[model samples]
Target: MRRLADASAPERRKWYARGAFFHAEDLHYLKFLIGEGARVLELGCGTGELLAALRPRYGVGVDFSAGMIGEAHKAHPHLTFLVGDIEDEAFIRQLPGPFDVILVVDTLGAVDDCQGMFENLHALCARETRLIVGYFSHLWYPALKAAETLGLKMPQPAQNILSPADVGSLVALADFEAVKSERRLLLPARVFGLGRLFNRFIAPLPLVSSLCLRHYTVCRSLRHRSADVRSASIVVPARNERGNIEPAVQRIPRFVEDLEIVFVEGHSQDGTWAEIERVRAVYPHYDIKAVKQPGKGKSDAVFAGFEVARGDVLIILDADLTVPPEQMPKFWEAIRSGKGEFVNGSRLVYPLEVQAMRFLNLIANKIFSILFTWLLSQRFTDTLCGSKALRRSDYARLKAARGYFGEFDPFGDFELIFGASKLGLKAVEIPIRYASRTYGQTQISRFRHGVMLLRMVVFAFLRIKAM
Candidate 1:
């Protein structure tokens, strides 16, 4: 295997240039999976082309073959290249790293001990690091062999043909959790722009997606965490819930000693802002803060509150008090214990209170839940639940990357949901009993919001799946 790799080192650029279109597609998906300016480490990085294309702030490429490392250094002098066996425990442990993203593209199948390689990779990962593995689908083995025989691709030594399921199992065996997995690239070569159309539209469809050529799985180390207790910030986006202001604070369980509650009133006419101020004054013992949102929707209000929040963990609490404040502790514990990086409240699990949700709304929530489960590759029982928790640092990362989706969400639910999915945060849902509002009418319009949701579904498809 080493001899074959060494012999092909001289022609590496030639082969990649011949298949420029195919390679470009792979790079497109990789760029989407990895953010720019991250600390990156790539194993079996042949010629370092992919690593250089990623534009990492600090980039390192390692390969077992000296010829490949030499070529990589000559081609991309900005990146560090080293010739070392990835399966060697001593060699892998000596590297300096806690990289933000690690790439193992098509390298696992060539290694003798895949599980050992994955275990060694844990040394290079922090809690937020993501391990991305991209490989060719075993179903395309015959086509790849034919291309190699025809001199259209680089020749390779005999290697294992692993499926997505196989890779997922190996990840689990190495104590890593598989967060997301998918297949793409229906057409490897671009033929008069039809390849782009088919790959973008028809290739990602349900049954059709399974037949694609490329497979990618993203995993994160499960054992990486800190045991320190984190502070908490709960932002309540209030509209007209004047009567529920004081009770919202009082009902909250003492989840943590260092906690701050922020109330963002959104141009309510029912004296909600005055009620928030009164509650702040009355609760001298509790740390309460009130602020009027500069904008109209719940999304704006929540973000406004987040801007001023000073806590290790940030949570959203609906001012309507439908999802009881008592449930806040569950979210806090879920995040603090490292059970999940993002904790979402699920109202669909337990029985609903009288008039908690209307018939149509319940049906819509179920349908959206299914759609989001498919779209995000993470199961979501309730997508629009206003109660959620995530570390403030994760929120800052998500907020920085928010420009990709733009300001599309008005209810504030999809903003966090989409952001969490993009950041590869481990999502865990906590079951909570749903209750009807006691003070004010619901701020939702069934038909109008339903139409808007349909639009969001289409928008998400274009932004997430089609891309």
Candidate 2:
């Protein structure tokens, strides 16, 4: 296989060009998964196209074919490319450690020992690092073989035909957890633009997704946390919730050693700003900060609070106090213990308090949860929950890459949820006993928000599922 690849290296660019549409779609999904200026490493990098396209702060490509590495160096001199067999333990040991994202795109089939290759990657990952392994789905074997015979696709050496289950099993054997798995690109050719429609819409549908030509499995290291104690910043977005101000602060337990509370007032007419000031003064012993949002929506308020926040972890705690502050420890522990990267509150898990949620709202939450679960390729029990938690570093990365989704989210929940999904952060739900608001009327206009949510569903479909 090495000799074959080395012999074919010079013609690799022509082969990829012949399949331009498919190659471009593959790169598009990769760019969506990986943020620009990340530290990236790619194995089996043919001509280094995938690595260079990522525009990483530090990019490295490794391939067994010397010819491929030569072409890669000539094309992308900025990136580091090496000619070495990834299957060799000694060769793997010499490479750098701790890349932000590691990619094995379309090359896993040639691997002789998949489990050993994955095990070797352990040293190349940090606790937060994500490993993406993309390959042709086993179901596409017949179609790919026919394409190769018909000269429509690049000919290949004999390789392993692995299913998602096979990849998941290998990942577990290597002591890594598969966070999410997705099937994509049903039609590999542009047949009068019908391929785009099939790939963007029909391909993502429930049963039809099984027919996708490519599959991606996202994995994360299960290593222990580097530090035992981490600080937290809980951002409370208050809007006309004056009566719940002090209680919100008072109920919060100091779960972490260092905790800071930030209250962002969103132009509330009911003296919410005055109440925030009062709470800041009253909670002198507690680290508290208050700020007025420059814009109107909750998303704006959350971002404003994030700017002033100074903690290792950032959390969104609603000022309405529906999701009790006492349940915050679960979120902190989830991140601290490496259980999940993005912690979301799930009000639908445990029984809600009487009058806590309306029937229509409850039905909508369930429907959106299913939709998001499918859209993200990660299970989400509740999508509209106001409380969410993530590391400040992860939040920084998400904020930097927010342009892909834009500022389309008004309620602030979907923004974080979407960003977390795009960044490949493991989403975990902590069941919370949602309670009825005690002090303020509900600010959400059901019909207006419903229409907006429908629009967001379409937006997410385009940005997420359709790529």
Candidate 3:
């Protein structure tokens, strides 16, 4: 602490101006983590390069050195600045309230007390907070030493050499989950064509990108949420098929532990709501609620039902019964096994009931599956057969990040798929038998819905693949 106090302000300023190793680091980080209009707090924002790159409308930069804070203020005049130790609870207390994205670039490695820093940062985040942390990898310590010796990168102090697991442990101790952790380089694309090649070939592949230059960690804030394992939301959006309600509920496999049924009666000319109420009366033992959709379509109806749902796991079950209730246990098993954050039902793999899908539908499903697999770098065997499962915690993250895709999706498939892709969640598909809908006429307008699907595909290309 004495040596740090005696360190000349001009020395720190010179070091910052030189911009060693991490000059362009924030550009990628801002593109990947901190999107526009987000409220962001940056710890140890020396020279404020990342702060300026993110262009946060509500940005706050913190640093311990008065010189660093001055330089940050000069470099990024728009952002608010507070010169204080990140570990100081009283200092964090004096600042403003919670932020959406809190960054700690190159802060943890230098902190004298890493545990204190983690505890304090946990206090600054809400349940939906995202923290992007990166530091030079200790695995590359030899290369760094070699580079410094060769005078490529400057070296002076004995910086703390830590592993990715060390940082992740600290994050977990802070009560946040490490959603994504990766290693990226300071190397330029032009100079290293092979590096760029890896980005195209191997990096986009699921599960391989985690080990690439410096250690990068993306953490989600913690909430003491209880999984009302029994309070299940079964959403069945039905249309002209008025006869399916009672059978759907009765046939819906009792896979979940605690269950409640919410029937989203969407624009059905048939007495779907009346039938739902009839079913509720018949099965007084079941927790059943019927809501006639004020909206027009399945996507809108699903969103509406979700708004009124009070459950831990929100499930989408098509009224057509293409996916039987008995198969839901497979989804539960996939989720419980921690195979994926989102468990999508794949009808293409298993044998479907004869006449399950028309020839064109099967072809379209296969084509879109290939395209999305290529685009999001995640495999999906079927995209249109509307059955998806995820936790409410994940749904909250999607809601918070809705601006990323806006309200353009009408099918509801893009919402979860795109959200999970961007959030770096492991999306797994479970094979299920597709039973042809027994009760209702199909509501999907082939041409109109196909066009919407095409629009979503293009939108997803830009949002997930191109970006």
Tens digits of per-residue lDDT, candidate 2, 1-467, equal 77888899999999989999998888888888888898999999989988998999999999989999999999999999999888888888888968999899887888889999988888888877899999988888988898999998889977799988899999989888898999999998899999888888888889998989989999987753342447999999999999999998889999987999999999999999998888788779999999999998888999999999998888899999999999999989988887889999999988888999999999999999999998888989999999999988889988987887777678888888889998888889999999998998988888888888888888999999986
Q: Compute the lDDT for candidate 2.
A: 0.89
Residue pairs in steric clash, candidate 1? none
- Between candidates 1 and 3, the one scoring higher on TM-score is 1
Choose 1 or 3, whichever is better by lDDT.
Answer: 1
Cα lDDT listed for each candidate: 0.90, 0.89, 0.72
Q: How do the predictions measure up, each by TM-score?
A: 0.98, 0.96, 0.67
Q: Which parts of model 1 have CA positions greater than 4 angstroms off?
A: 226-229
Candidate 1 has a TM-score of 0.98
For every candidate, C-alpha RMSD to the true structure in Å = 1.1, 1.7, 6.1
Kindly give the number of clashing pairs for every candidate: 0, 0, 5
Q: Once model 3 is optimally superposed onto the true structure by TM-score, how far is the C-alpha of residue 354 displaced, in angstroms?
A: 2.6
Per-residue C-alpha lDDT of model 1 across residues 192-227, encoded as one tens digit per residue = 888888888888899999999999998999878542
Candidate 3 clashing pairs, residues 3+ apart or interchain: 183-213, 184-213, 230-258, 241-440, 253-325
Give the higher-TM-score candidate: 1 or 2: 1
Q: Candidate 3's residue-wise lDDT over 79-124, tens digit each? A: 8988887888889877785887888877776788876677777667
Predictions ranked by lDDT, top down?
1, 2, 3
RMSD of 1: 1.1
What's model 2's TM-score?
0.96
Model 1 alpha-carbon miss at residue 327, Å? 0.6
Model 2 lDDT, residue 157, Cα:
75
